[model samples]
Target: MRLRHITGSEDFVADSPYVVHRSERYRGVWNRELFPKPQPIHLEIGMGKGQFITQLAVLHPERNYVGIERYDTVLMKALRKRESAEAAGCRLENLRYLSLDARLLPEHFAENEVSKLYLNFSDPWPKARQANRRLTSQVFLDCYTKFLRKDGTLEFKTDNTGLFDYSLESIPAAGWTLLAVSRDLHRDPVLNEGNVMTEYEEKFSARGNPICKLIAAPPK
Candidate 1:
């Protein structure tokens, strides 16, 4: 599902008045007109090219999705895809993007605001000193606890074995209970189905690397 040239000419004003501002950062917010009723909010950090969340938003229209990507170059692709989805009138009223750092999550969302968090093929800072920067680190997980609901879930996938192993050990320390873990996602078709492959995932899986996935929940 790769395109030779994604629409990149249209620039989005991050500070547009319509955008929601919190603690100096901007992100799109869904109004009551879009949902009619309050819906559960789900977030995906580092949503590369928006393939995963875009499909998820279309499939689960009952829930709202927010994708956070720091890089505008890559973020534009996701926006284009979302715009196309919206133009078709295909149930894309629930999706939005945030160009901000993952560390700034607390400022934008209130306590118990997010129901689920997705981390897919995040950067694996393989060095020891850089471990804190990993998205699955205890520090970041602790930050998420501030916004995640009591029964909130964190779904993660990565092709890096080191990161996967590190997460398996860090989740408990961060006060999250590991619910499901898989070293080879392809073996389980049910969960794999409708799972949109990211740019990195498509490349690594093509090389025969088994993708690792896990589901963790905040301890009640």
Candidate 2:
């Protein structure tokens, strides 16, 4: 699949007021000192338009959140939501955004730094050759295993059956133990209540497509 160019509006370097450094030392210093407490460092990869993370930050003030979206054009929307929340005195001190490729994830996070990782409605990348590029591919899961805490869990949701099937197989191969799998997220009212729907999730569900959700935890 061809990659689209990210616009300047969503460029973190160009738009984010927070210090977004890629250096390991810089990340350590910021996480330890700059950010408050840093107890629950949950990561939302590919946060499009910011609706989900914004709601999460608003509702859960105790857990710190890190949103990573590479596409600047799409990322700007999430940033705006954060800015608005802050302005309104929502005081979501636990939220932040990073603009970079997931491949560079290890560079910015220390070992066992992340508690939870959320992959919400990432691109299907429908072609056979693009399978390796899927967010839940073995390569990416391996990266998560390196940075996530031993008992950490990965929550993945998508509307694409093909991608979901591929992930179910790939995650286990990468050494993660699949704990729960669902073909229809909405049918599970308990899951639905806790979930903060993404822009794509709403759109897909509105169109009557069943959302596929799964949770995998690292081996004990």
Candidate 3:
């Protein structure tokens, strides 16, 4: 998918307090002082257009929410959404964005720092050779384990069956225990309740696509 490059997106991000300019500088200090109340940090990796993470931040003001995106153009959209929300009198003090690659997670987060991780409709990287690039691949799972707390849960939702299957296998292979699995997320009334929808999730599910979801935790 071609991203519409927003002119001055980089400049906007640099000026916004919501975007962490030098994320690595904070590192282990994020929880101590970055957010107002030192709440448990919940991260949404590959946050597209900011829908899910932003809504989560609004719904749960007690928790700190961070949305990480690699593309400046995409991150800009997410940042703008926060601005719009604030303009409409929404309090988003606990929300923030990081324009960085997922691979650098360890450099910016301390061990057991993140309380929960969300992977929403990440790139499938379907080709056999590109399998490792999938967010659910062992490469990324290993990276997540380093930052997630002992009982930290990683919740994932995707429309791609191949990627979902791969994640089911990869999680256990990486020594994480699968806590829950749902092939059809919306069908499960228990999981569907209070489930925030991502941009892709709403688009796909409207077309009758069965969304896949799972929750897994690092082994103790």
Clash pairs detected, candidate 2: 10-72
Residue 167 lDDT (model 1): 99
User: lDDT of each prediction vs. the true structure?
Assistant: 0.80, 0.82, 0.91
Can you rank all candidates by TM-score, best first? 3, 2, 1
For 33-110, candidate 1 gives per-residue lDDT tens digits of 334457998999999788889888888988988888877667777777777777987777677677779998887777
Residue 97 displacement (Å), model 1: 1.2
Best by TM-score: 3
Report clashes for each candidate as comma-separated counts: 0, 1, 0
What is the per-residue lDDT of model 3 for residues 1-220, given as tens digits with 9 covering 90 to 100?
A: 6778888988877888888878888898897768888999999999989989989999999999999998888888898888889898889989988988899999999998899999999999889999889888889989988899998999999999999999999899989999999999999998888999999999999999999999999878
- Clash-forming residue pairs, model 3: none
Task: Kindly list the per-residue Cα lDDT of model 2 for residues 1-220, writing each as its tens digit.
Answer: 4656565674455746652655465554446754787577889999888889888888988888888888777777677777787788888777877888898888888778888999999988889999878999987988877778898899999999999999999989887899888899999876666877998999999999999999999755
Q: Which candidate ranks first by lDDT, i.e. highest? A: 3
- Candidate 1, residue 32: lDDT: 45
Model 1 CA lDDT for position 83? 71
Better of 1 and 3 by lDDT: 3
lDDT of 2: 0.82
